[model samples]
Target: MTAFNPITISCFKAYDVRGELDVNLDNAIAYRIGRAFAQYLNDGKENPVIVVGSDIRPSSESLKQSAIDGITDAGIDVIDLGMVGTEEVYFATSHYNAIGGIEVTASHNPINYNGLKMVRENSRPISGDTGLADIRAIAERGEFVVADKGRVTLNTDKTAYIDKLMSFTDTTKFTPKKIVVNSGNGSAGPVVDELQKRLGDNIELIKVHHTPDGSFPNGIPNPMIIANQKATSDAVIAHGADFGVAFDGDFDRCFLFDEKGRFIEGSYIVGMLAEVFLKKHQGESIVYDPRVIYNTENVIAQNGGTPAISKSGHSFIKQVMRETRAIYGGEMSAHHYFRDFAYCDSGMIVWLLVIELLSVTGKTLSELVNGHINDFPSSGELNFRLGQKTASEISELLEQKYHSSNPAKNTLDGLSLDFGNWRFNLRSSNTEPLIRLNIETKGDKALLKTKTDEILAVLDECGAVSADH
Candidate 1:
């Protein structure tokens, strides 16, 4: 008998199921998860159908097929939406009225990785307590208890998804603007290629590394990495286009760059997107993650819309958006979810809106987004491994020390403390065994450093390093 790794059997996490491909997320485990998910959602129904989608990663096909077989074996039907992003799965599930959906994607991870994110009815996400842990536990046991097997179906080429995205906004107003898009060579290539062909040369899009190369030749599809953004920024400057846009592996999170070759931090993108969405549909509420500065709230409010601050996870943001009927939601991590897209995030949709924003505003990308260079400097999303420590342990100690006494502290996501005029959030990673921290403060750059140092000192006491883990 071969030895089994616990990480593989126990890796389905709070937000979704993720780990390295082949090692933790192999076909056998995917098969079991499919069966387990079908059983869990069906509750002994006649025939529960699920919509399955996968990105363009090489291994996605095999894993998705195995999951489909597992679900079918458990007497559930699978509607395969092949080669689509996560948002498309959400759309198919909701549109077709399936029990739930599964999207096989690793969103922004390195080339050697892959995983899955699941949702129950109404496109609601399945997380740790919500159901991921149970699914992982069932898959690990690897025992089959099914009397009748289900069926598997296929539906590729998401024409409706693409059309719906285009219909959500009035592109005519935003046309005639030359924009640059670099999709980081993930699953976004086909979608971007089609969009460029449809939009024609009038947009002057500079598509770089937008092909479906699972090898990730142009560095992983993550645009947030300074290393990955180099090509996009250079292309923007070289082509003399207005700005640049890049997508992650599954094209869910988008990062931006100005014509002057400056990376606009994602917090600004969240705020800018919020403003644009509110302007289009007057008084629509916007959802925002708690990691970045609350400037998003101010921007949405100033734009005559309500701003609802939610936790940092995509699932949390989507839930908040659905509950509040928010027009749009954005996290500082570059994930932007939309209610119009069945409460799922889409990097392509976000970039499309930004293009319209530029055309309608008639201002340079820098001019429109520069004013929001984060009045409060922040250390975006910093991850620190906690060997034997959990966020709860550190959070308990710090609450009384800083937050409880301050009385103005916020625990909406994790622990957000406001010391005088500065603020920061010390939270746990939704998917990893790491302690995540974010520090933001007013225009005073020195104060930002001091606050960050203070938090770091406390985290160090709990055996966390200041360096990225």
Candidate 2:
């Protein structure tokens, strides 16, 4: 039996665990979290097993080993999937019938940080509302039931996962087209390579930064960062590709770019995917976050599907998907969830669907999305770094200013107000210390810009600096 050593861990987040290295998270804390996760899932089960994976971060391997140690110490066998994306852990957890799974990945955080995203059986998310609080409490208490150590097995085979991805679209119908794929030197590179081999010769891929380097030689894998987008955009234009796709550190969320190197807003992609799913599964419920709604709502309504609104986080979206039996769910932040994919979001699956859409429609990526963009001109998610003001204070101030307009108001996730032809959603980010604002005007670019500027001015008055600047 291990001696009890209670230590406070501050790495636990609303959804996953994240913190700066050696400060809020370290080997000891990781070990405790692993043990806690196993204990929480054990529940009188015999020889419970857990799947573990990690991203390409420098600290991930060691942290993963420590976590595996903790799980094993709790007498839970582990299946290590080697270095892989977060979704792979999700898939493996369900694929192997494991009781739980954890992916040691900070995913687009600064190089100095690393953390874990965990899930229970059947790839169900383990957020604060579910089992994360209990796991955290167990870790903090540092007490465990004595049991014989469990064994660890190496299972790096991704054939099953690759097969699952290919099942989303028929490659036979995929027209011969060139595509620029920028992996940003993260874990996506290997997955992309494997996908390329399976894709055969019909699709030509122009790979950029397609190497897994923990040092982040190109930059952080987050294409949402304007600075990081230039690589994929430039490659798309330079190669005259059909379209471009880029993935974050863990490859869970992918960002798309048009042939003209224009970064397609995630809201528009959500609308496009909603249309795709609704066409195939008519009258089914589709879940979307309240952050950006006009385009998605319009599309779902047009396609004979019901639109179910959910909060902005993955856990909330997944729960709503299950509740509504949604055929698909999307967030403006590039997280796309599928009913068939265990209600888990996958960056790879999204791009594949986009590819199939393009092939089936025979339309340029821009051509396919242009109608939605024009009909609902939007200010794609502008983030503001708060100064001296909390998000709640700013929300109250904004409400005070806008509530007099008698617009339709909804606080499903944050503040959403619709004044007939125009609307906006102002909310705080779940992960970062920032406020996200999204606005859209019905086919009115002038109004979109004017309202965007007006909102920024009000935010400026509150000492909130634009993160884009």
Candidate 3:
């Protein structure tokens, strides 16, 4: 008699699989995940192929190899795209007409961690409710149907993916400009180099930390961290560049800095991208998350476009984009999605579109976003680590206190209260043990500060410590 041993995998999250290496994930787990994913997505299709890729993490190569072995063992052909960004897998899945794809990357997580982002045919996201849960169940069960092993092939071509990016705008219109690009020693360097060749001599790129280093000597490539942003910001100022762009580990999110080396909040970037897209495709719907609304809402309305709101997350945004047929969708967290890009988010596309907007309009990055920033002063996202108190308890307390003010409310993704001129959104982090807060007001810098402080006081009362501290 064979014994059945049930294994528990804690890496599977609401949207993707992320875990601490050797703890929640390893080569064994990666292999099982790949086998399960192939089984779940095959759907009796013949010659089923799965595209696989990995980032620059030291552990990613072996993990990817194990995944490929498992997929091929399950009679699924594998296309190995060695050491690429997450979006590249998305591109390959749709571009090659594969059954599905997986990218072995932990993104901006700590070095001890690694994870995987997956998508089905046509690059459709496989979230928890989609196919991730089934994959998780299969992986946990550790059961597989026997079949003839398949073959593996290598595909390192980025030409098609780069071509698709260039299709977003007219390259001939790119004016001569010096730009600072910091890849944060992650997977973005190779792609940036490819872009430089296509960009020609008209645009000078001042590259910083533009190498793939697994050690992450310059820190984890997370531009959202204030400390990690200095390298990009300082390079921009030192080189006297027009603007600067920084990316995370997998390069799925790109953060921007103005000529003055001032970090531009993601919400403001969302508003600017919304306006850019609307101008090109008039009356098209633009989807945005519920984190900060006034700036994005105003921009969409003024540009003759409808604003579609969705919960904050890649899966939610992509689903909303498809349902609304939105031309572009962006989150204040620096994720930007395009309809043409198989509804997948790409940091590369975001910068390309921004550069095109800059050249065609003959406007500086600041010149374009300054008005929106002034009109809708925002508190930028604030993170708080809770102590004893739960997010719900804190939210309920805030609601009870402000209920008498008659502020309009919405619970789309979290607790959002709009008091006519001022609004705020408080939600727990989807990926971390923290709570996020964003505040915005109508053209009132002083009010923005006042309200921001007011909210901080309330959070402090709830024993929530600022993540910054």
Candidate 4:
């Protein structure tokens, strides 16, 4: 579609399209991506409709224009949703029966980060192993001609989406009181603020950095990072709210905290939400990432449903959710996907469900999670920035040296060693080049700690330097 050089274009990535600015990611790349998708998928129609949305990131606005140009070059009509969350982008795409869709966001990555997540017609995800590879190949080759030039127009449906969000739960359902939310100045701020305005103090609110700021002054907006969560945890304690909520850059995922300022493990949230969703939609399947508490499988089964373990990635989880028609799917990373949301992950939906559950039960977040806490003692994700490329070698060594004698081993996502009572999932970071280690024990916290220490020692001993960030 647009005439662009092949060498200068490389915004394509495994799960989506992301790269450095100018060098790898720029207007040219964005335009090429738009053109590639339009030409590859939506051709022929005078105005093949596609929904496009962008985040608050500085580089996104210009790049978004380039994408629109690309799409128009291929004779596609663009419904620009303007600045919104990635989930909203998905919602617009599916809601309007668009031929293709694109959401411009960098998510939890640093300030310099920028990227795009695209899907074919009818909200089908373009994942790495599935369709992203083909997109990448097209982007790399970068030699396509535009058959028709189309147009992009601004469309405002955020209010309609907000209405849809509130409609999920009845007004009389539950009035969760005194909950603190931290948006970290990401795109979720406005949405959360709107929810507060609409809900009108049904839940007491404590807002932290509610304004949008692409430069995450508090931190990188990732609540999983203890440092980034300091402000949120502190606010929860200061306000004595029922729970704390947080959102990353594009706000597709949400992380939580208990009343006592304790960070709630994502594993517990998955179990709680699974139970709630399954209760509403009886006998449905629930999808979950394999890196969470093993008890999640038991909880889903006990709730009169099926449990499907998926790889640790939004794209993969989404794929599995669609294939199984799972009512709910969650990742230990706080990315929650719902069948109601077209199998797309939504931080807002998960937290909304949480608020409803807490409101109806009149129980504190701590009380709700207490039942799921001791199911397993887990060493939350420990990241190591290996200066060497010996991650595979080290993983093999660990498997041969320790996991070899385990009761059973599963390498579905990475190296998952299962000893029946205690297990660990060693997985590599999808976005970053890091080997992340996770250890869990059914009834042994001491054993979990010991194993975690051993893995750290190995990382240090190997030909690499270790840094959590």
Candidate 5:
């Protein structure tokens, strides 16, 4: 048993618990967290039943066991859904009528990283504002009371989860197409294999790094980084595939590449999906993040659906979706949430819906997104490392510089300065000490480049270092 020392709060992030392993988060911390989470949900009348799942990270299994031990020690029953994606835990929590769920995963973080994502009833996340702060405090205190232990049951089957994912689309309407599915040796393999078993006849899947290996043999399973996409792009071109899809470590977020091996930004995909959902629902609300909005707003409005903007984050997006009763919600970072799926982000459902859109429209993935791309040429998210200036300092400088222009500033998630022809969002990352910048222009690639350069100059002047270093 690991000793009970106070764990650093660095692991308790805005949305979930995540940090470098051993340094801040470990089996001991996991166990303490489990006890704290159980105590939080336990009302004394009955023991809370909690669902637990884990990703393919090497440290995840032990951490999961420690958590389960702590929960059981607190007289909380646990159901272990072994080696599953984060969404599966969310699904299992609501599907089984459990009080809550916890998924052990680092989710696209470095191999040395690991963490937990917790949710309450109805798959609602437990973030800082919700329950994470309390949980963190309990864990750090390490003053858990001993009680009659509860039992744990192993139920590793993913059939129900896959069925739920398949329910989002019509398999009969799926046109036969050869595509590359890159799991990047993450937890996506088993789920993707199950999905293939259901639709193998219609979809020709070219598997790349399809095996689940916690070692992350394919360089971190994060396709958001341009270099990390090389394997998927190469496989797509080599196999003459229709398109390529890549999943993160926990398979909660997915990224896309075109048949031509060009990466498609997530903002355009959000717009495409808005149009798709609007066609079916006709007038349902669609939730989107405020970072890049023109394309999504335009498409949602044109398609007779309302576009609601929310602060960027899974917890924030899900809450907004529930409040607005939105049918769909998406972020530019590739997290897509569906109302049918308990408002939880699923990496599988988004790609499947895109495939369905492609089949119905008889258009290539590039064709589907090119119009939005041309309409809203954007500088994909650019991260600048903090130097002498802090994130707040840099943001203040940008606001001061642009304040006089009166370019329709919005301080929702960050500072969004909107000009008639071009706009930019400059926000500090919630998880990292870096400033994120996004610039987009209406039908003007030149304006996008010019504005991007102008922002880069400002960032440079504000003591920000390029991420390239």
Candidate 6:
């Protein structure tokens, strides 16, 4: 038996486990996490089963196998769903009646990093506040219960998962449209190929960097970064496609590009999706993040859908979606969740629904979102690298400065200050050392710019911005 090596618990984050490979995270740590997760899910029951999946990262297979070994060692049956996106693990967990699921993926991280996303039965997330802390503590302890090893089985049938994703909208209503899909050489290719095969003549799917390459020769599939978006935008322009879609490494979050080769902000997409859902199911609830709110609120109100605000993260969005029974939930970060799909976010399903909306409306992507963009012009999310002061400290100072006006404020996830005509949200990133800022003004582009600059000045005063910049 290989002696277990004790490792630091830093890889376990607020939402999922992620870190640089072989440094803060490695196969040894993965094994321990598997064992710990199994112990957590056992719940005084026998024959607890776990579904395991991995992305296309070079190190994912080795880490997955080691984790499986630890899980089986704890007498938990393992259903191996090989080489899949993170959402597939969530689907499999619910489909197979497993006690829990784990996806070995460092989603959208650099090539040198790898990690895991875990969930409990019914595809409910295991975040730090829920059960990740306990798993971290147990894994750090390195103690295991002696039990007979369990069985491991392999299953890669994604037919049901694909069918379920398509069930959100009627295919008969889909009109043929040429669209570009840039997989960014990540784990999304296989799933896209499968869905494309099912769609047949309904869409002209233009593929770019569609192969699943762990080396990420192009780059990691983070479309949020402006530099990383050129490929999708260029492809859309070159192909004259209706629109372009890009996915992260694990295909759980997706971004959009318009027919004119312009990157569309996720906030506008949220408003459009809310309208789509509400047109069919009026008075239903729609959940949105507090980052940029005017467009979503206006669209939901006009479409007769109740708007609910939630913290901006996959776990929080999914939890709030379930609590509010929201038909759809979207965040400016491009994570879209649906109540129909076990309240979990899925990149594949997002694009499919977008296609359905485009077909039903007979409008280009730009046309679909332009009205909202005009109504709620926004300064896209800006990140300030902190130097001396913490995000909370800066937030407090800004709050003091604006409190004299007695603006509507909420601290649900961060500092959301609504000044009637214009508003901004200042929040610290869950995984990084930067403070993110999002500002929006009602139909006033000039005010948007002025207020954005004003906020930057405030950040400078608060030492949230580095002095060198």
TM-score of 2: 0.98
TM-scores of the models, in the order given: 0.89, 0.98, 0.98, 0.95, 0.97, 0.96
- Local distance difference test, each candidate: 0.78, 0.91, 0.92, 0.80, 0.89, 0.89
Stretches off by above 4 angstroms in model 4 are: 1-4, 43-46
Which of the predicted structures, 1 or 6, would earn the higher lDDT when compared with the native?
A: 6
Report the Cα lDDT for candidate 4. 0.80
lDDT, residue 311, candidate 2: 93
lDDT of 4 by residue, 1-469 (tens): 3445666355566678888787778887788788777777755654569999998888888989999998887777889998888888888888888888999988877777789988876577887677677666676688777555777789865887888788766656767478788888888887887787677547778889778877766667777777788888899889878888888888888899988998887887888888887787778999998786576887888889888888888778888888998988888888888787788888887777777888788888889877667667688777777766467788787787784566577777888877787777777887887777778888677887887888777777786555555
lDDT of 1 at 41: 86
Tens-place lDDT digits, model 6, residues 285-365: 999999999999999989999988998888888888888999999999888888888888888888888888888888899
lDDT of 3 by residue, 1-469 (tens): 1112669999998899999999999999998899889888988886789999999999999999999987987789999999999999999999999999999999999999999899999999999999899999988888886778988999998999999988887788889888899998999999999998898778899999998999999889888888988998899889899899999999999899998899999999999989888988999999999999898999898999998999999999999999999999999999999999999999998887777888888989999889989999998899999987899999999899898999999999889999999999999888888999999999999999998998899899889998853
Cα lDDT, model 2, residue 369: 92
Worst 10 residues of 6 by lDDT: 460-469
- RMSD (Å) of each candidate, 1 decimal: 3.6, 1.0, 1.3, 1.9, 1.9, 2.1
RMSD to the native, candidate 1? 3.6
Off by over 4 Å in 1: 1-8, 43-47, 141-148, 387-407, 453-463, 466-469
lDDT against true structure, model 6 = 0.89
State residue 122's C-alpha deviation in candidate 4, in Å: 2.7
Residue lDDT tens for model 2, 1-469: 5667887889888899999998899998999999989989997777689999999999999999999999999999999999999999989999998999999999999999999999999999999989999999999999986778999999999999999999998888888789899988889988898888987687899999998999998888889989999999999988999999999999999899998999999999999999998898999999999988899999998999999999999999999999999989999899999988899999999888877888889999999999999999999889999987888888788788888898898898788889999999999888888899999999999999999988888889889988874
> How many steric overlaps does candidate 1 have?
2
lDDT of 1: 0.78
- Candidate 5 stretches greater than 4 Å from native: 1-9, 44-47
Candidate 4, poorest ten consecutive residues by summed lDDT? 1-10
Put down candidate 5 lDDT per residue, 1-469, tens digits, no spaces: 2335665555888989888888888888888889989878777646569999999989999999999999998888999999999999989999988889999998888899999999998899888999889988878877676778999999988888889999998888988888899998999998888888888588999999999999987788888888888899998899998899999988889899888988899998898888888998999999999899999999998999987999999999999999999999999999999998899999999888877888888989999888889999999999888888887777788788777888988899888989889898988888776778899999999888888888788788877887732
Query: Which residue runs of candidate 6 sit more than 4 Å off their true CA positions?
Result: 1-7, 44-46, 462-469
TM-score of 6: 0.96
In model 4, residue pairs whose N, Cα or C atoms come closer than 3 Å (at least 3 residues apart or on different chains), thus clashing, are 99-121, 178-204
Q: How many clashes in each candidate?
A: 2, 0, 0, 2, 0, 0
